[model samples]
Target: MTSPDQPNPEAVSDETLFGADVADYARYRPGLPDAAIHLLAATQHGVPDPVLLDLGTGTGQVPRALLPVLRRLVHIDLVDVHQHMLEAARAALEPVRGSCTVSAFTGEAHTFTPAMPGLAPTLITSCRSFHWMSRPRVLAMADRVAAPHAVVAIMGDGSLWTHEADWTATLRRLIQTYLGDDRRAGTRGTYAGPGRPYEDDLADSAFSDVSEHCFPVARAWTPEDVLGYLRTTSFARPALFADRYREFEAEALGLLKAHARGGVLKEDAEFTVLLARRPGGAA
Candidate 1:
């Protein structure tokens, strides 16, 4: 499901749509569950020093979370269209990358080529950013770069705007009052849902053998935390509100405070990962 904050796939460039919020995103966006990383690493069990290709690797959250666990992971190719996001990801991964070599590529995911020779990825990951890409094209490109047993993992969870909670409803209503009924993605237009399921797209791609996994996550947010998270999202980005941005913040803070129990808000969400591989492979 598309949220008010999710960018319209047709409206703008990836950098313009997401780069403006890079700092906030790096600070507030949730990391992948440890169990999910374990599941991803388990797929590459016997492979010695496997390579990882992470598409749409915003701030390198997936790599940062997976590097500590996947001792066999030897190299990582972080691909993104935004230079700032690529730099942020490189910085985040460098300090912790013990035996692994991390490299960043500033370009669209579908067209990215690995910088290192003979680098066929054993595991390819896209977290919370696959929706921005052309699935078939990316899968075709992956086919050219992936090893025989490579697994393509697509993972995401709903955003704060899509979460069902009393405080969220109230906050959404306030946004609607100011931004109108339509969910404003940027200055250009509103969001349109991806018409079909991602599974359907993957089913039609080269990576047709698919398996799914889900992790239940419980989160606690302070009023300040919620505000900080909003700053990272497309719907409530400060630049989108312009002159009324501070006004919206004041009212939103008041609403959050009214609903908070000891300045804390609670949410229950499910993080899902879909792992796909070529038919007859051991993904």
Candidate 2:
């Protein structure tokens, strides 16, 4: 039975959930030095080597990218709602084992409580993962869980293909050429994309005494890379489709190849990062 307030699990599977596509997400995905890095730079003025907490850390990209830059950070707590996503993050961070200590766990954002002793962190960040959380619940958790000077940065509401024209038309044309117009309700629109707007509830609220900014990042994707990425999308899964899977795949590849620059499709993706600091704790 579906509850009025809760997400419909039957309508969505964890494999197809927000945590999916984490493997190729960091590899083929563009827009690094994303909102999280910007937030770290802003609050890093006086803080040296402060403990870091990464919420909704998919494939450990944010921490892995930011680890080299922090002056004095020793440990990172990577939290996620899905165990599999955390596992992927663990694997990605293994090559850089000596850089920083990492503790990964699976738990709901609302009920999550750090078990680490004396673990009040100086920085807490979420990259492209904040939208799944309920705003009020997350705010309450932030208020209680963070150290006084903790910085919370949530990045989302950014688009991967940000062409000025109706890119949706291009996307639809590609999908139709492959799938032949037989679309599932879940896979029909922009909602099926890997990116989404963050926290519709907090859409109206602005952070006080916190600086928020958006940075533009671009990446060039070959036909193969784009296909690999699209395959990671929720709609591209086997279970999600009733038929025409390979036909769709081939067509998608062919369509993008037609428009690819130098036989590559360059996607313009943008990420919105939210950086907020608690009053008085650590620098």
Candidate 3:
């Protein structure tokens, strides 16, 4: 998953900050929990084949997870600012093309223009990537492009850096020692927490009928898997450390190995989904 933090106050481009890590991201990031998909599907029960527009669809994790459950979906549009990430998402969704029309767009979440006319999405989703967006702008864009009564879902779980497991805490300490206490993102900036909760943003937008759901997920990680996951995160992308990348890896692995229990570290995360829809009925 890409870091939700804006690269810097200077406004670095998402492609420059995250494109290089697309491969690792596609390989190692966790897919959305089944409950999230179920909730989304439930919201569309009576609708016919619907169009799904996923913004910041890094490697298509959200679409891929929903594919099996959203069998009736007629079209899926994946949008991202990074071409590499878009390419990866297209590749991941290729197998499902026989079931639905799948297309990709390279642009910001708030500014994407669908290629076809009358392509208003019936469901819009931004997983993990919502934090990187101009929330109000994106919501305004959603209001413009979404079908009436369309559900806009924003989902995320805390990253490994924030996990509370002993091994994870130790690992985080090691990262802080090398990268410093503030969470480093991209090349030169630290992550800034959102000033307000996403619920507030949705409550104030056109999609004001808002609800939230959380799913409990237990994850077991081997030292190697943990390291691979690190490669995909904003806080530990190799480019952020440059020449010291290998050295940092070696030290981090050693620390992880020391803390692992039976070659695995366990963490429990609450995957939260916030669902919003316009007050009026579907158009």
Candidate 4:
């Protein structure tokens, strides 16, 4: 969902963005921190028949992370534009399914409504995928789909590129050397970044009451892990490098190896979650 947005954008289209990187994304992308997971599940603490609708359900990461902790979560509806990613999500969640049922939709998050009537979500979540969607529209949709006490949780930590570290700086330079001065966005040219703070977006929507949570997350990455992660990023995906992608990868690996201590690279990040609710809403 880090890809650049074109005019009249929906969720980042699979064919242009992560069509070939879905496997790498599922394998290498870190799960939400345990503290974050507990907090999400805690929001549904008193609700009856809690349902979770993950708006930009990339490979079902948010739901997968929440399901194990949320025994009360009876149903999960995942929405993403990419069928391939949805297929991957469906397959991954199959082994974990117990009493709960999972359904996936391939379309804009703003347009999704549960097929079963009177089935509003107890919690609505948009993780890393929120920035790619039309923010205001999605929030308005959430207002309609969410129960009176439900909260719309927007969660993400900045990617590796945003991390301020020696290793990340070197990696960025390497990517710039092969690509260009700007971040390479899939199909849509350079990334312009999400201009407005997501907090502002929430304030402007129906969900005006917002609470923020910050979690300290420390991650260790091997050179191999870093390589796998780069494959999932729009800034360094193979498609952006043309025929020289192999050359770029070789150089990138060498640089990463040089930086690794005990064959490990460290990333410390602040993961933020904004839990938004309507005025006087409880959750």
Candidate 1 residue lDDT tens string, 102-216:
7777677887777775878999999987877878899999999999989999999978888899989889989888888877776447866556888998999889999999999
Across residues 141-221, which tens digit of lDDT does each residue of candidate 4 receive? 888878889888999998988899999999998999988899888876888788999999999998999999999999999
Q: How many backbone clashes does candidate 3 have?
A: 0
lDDT of 3 by residue, 125-236 (tens): 9998898888999999998888876899999998998888788888888888888999987654989777799989998999888888999998888889888999888898
Clashing pairs in 1: 5-235
lDDT against the true structure, each candidate: 0.83, 0.60, 0.82, 0.84
Point to the candidate with the largest TM-score: 4
RMSD after CA superposition, every candidate = 5.7, 6.7, 4.7, 4.5
Top-lDDT structure, candidate number? 4
Give the range where candidate 3 is weakest over 10 consecutive residues by summed lDDT. Answer: 1-10
Q: Is candidate 2 or candidate 4 better by lDDT?
A: 4
How would you encode candidate 2's per-residue C-alpha lDDT over 1-283 as one tens digit per residue?
1111122232222555544566666665554654547467657567655777777776777777776666366677777766667778777766664656677656656555665647676777776666455566766776677776677777764432334433335755666554456433234342443344343333433323455577665667687776666555543443344577676677667767777768866655555676665444343
Candidate 2 lDDT: 0.60
Once superposed on the true structure, which residue ranges of model 2 sit more than 4 Å away at CA?
1-13, 18-22, 34-39, 97-99, 160-168, 176-207, 279-283
Rank by lDDT, descending? 4, 1, 3, 2
Cα error of candidate 4 at position 164, Å: 0.6
